[model samples]
Target: MRRLGPSDYRDMPWKNGGGVTRELLKLPHPSEPARFLARLSIASVAASGPFSVFPGIERTLLVLEGAGMALTLGGAPEVVLDRRSPPFVFPGEAETSCRLLEGPVRDFNLMVDRALVEASLEVVHLAPGGTRTVPGTGSVLLHGVEGRASLSGTPLAGEETLWLEAPGPLVLRSDEGARVIVIHLTRRESSSSGT
Candidate 1:
């Protein structure tokens, strides 16, 4: 497994230009458009605001630092999320806005093309001993949310990520306790048949 660390994250302006977001990885790279399947990034929200819209995409956000956020999505009731809360999933096309709970907050985001990819995010409380195997199709992303860990023996520091394509039973182990974000992506839409 390969590792992407803090230094590898790309600093880019948000789609709405409200602030900047650090893009950790994009499946088709930063230059491609139509072929984008999955993307992972981190953004800091210093104030309450609206989120950038991305039609045909599904998004999940996990509070990595600070108090948390209260989100109003698609005319539904406002949902409050904190560091201990599970990741929130919503449609990218939905009208979404956020109200910070306390001060600024740092969050990790995962986006997948709704038409081509089905995605889910889960948090694992890892102990010092034992291995955690993540079974997935299409791709699996391991993010070290808190503390340090490893994927297939490759060291992943806090906030670092390891991307595995069509991964089988992947193993993760850590010497110290860790909090991990496991993103499972499966292909939902297919392309042309090989004829």
Candidate 2:
């Protein structure tokens, strides 16, 4: 497992050029083909606008800070989202737009090519010394939201992320009031039904 902090994150323009996002992690590092194969980021949205479309990607968005916003996804009914809400999942190709409910907001985003990966996200709260273990045979990301934690004795403070590849043993220790988002990623098994 590798502990990555804010200092490690990179700033880049949003896909639509409407704003910017701080990239948290990307599978296979940078400059790889199918860059969106599995990626995570935090985006700051200050204004309402259309979302950039990625034809083959699927994503989930979770409100991380501020009052949140209302999302009009494709032709679906408007939905209000905030930090307390569960992560919203949808196709990256959907015609999505957001209108801030109050002021600027921050969000956690996870994207992956549906053909290559199966991913899951969960938010959990922990107390001092509390430990969480991730199983092997896939990748998992522990994204800190509030308070502090440690991964295999390595400290991960607020807003930091821990990226782990296939391994047998892993543990995350948490402090009081520590809140985190765990993302589990696994390669999709080959199938014959498609043919």
Task: Report lDDT (CA) for all predictions.
Answer: 0.83, 0.83
Question: What would the per-residue lDDT of candidate 1 be over residues 63-175, giving only the tens digit for each residue?
Answer: 88899989998788999999989889899989899999998999989998777678899988888875788785677888888778877777877878888887677777888
- Model 1 local distance difference test score: 0.83
Q: TM-scores across all candidates?
A: 0.89, 0.88
Badly placed stretches (over 4 Å) of model 2 are 15-17, 28-35, 191-195
Question: Which pairs of residues collide in model 1?
Answer: none
Residue pairs in clash, model 2 = none
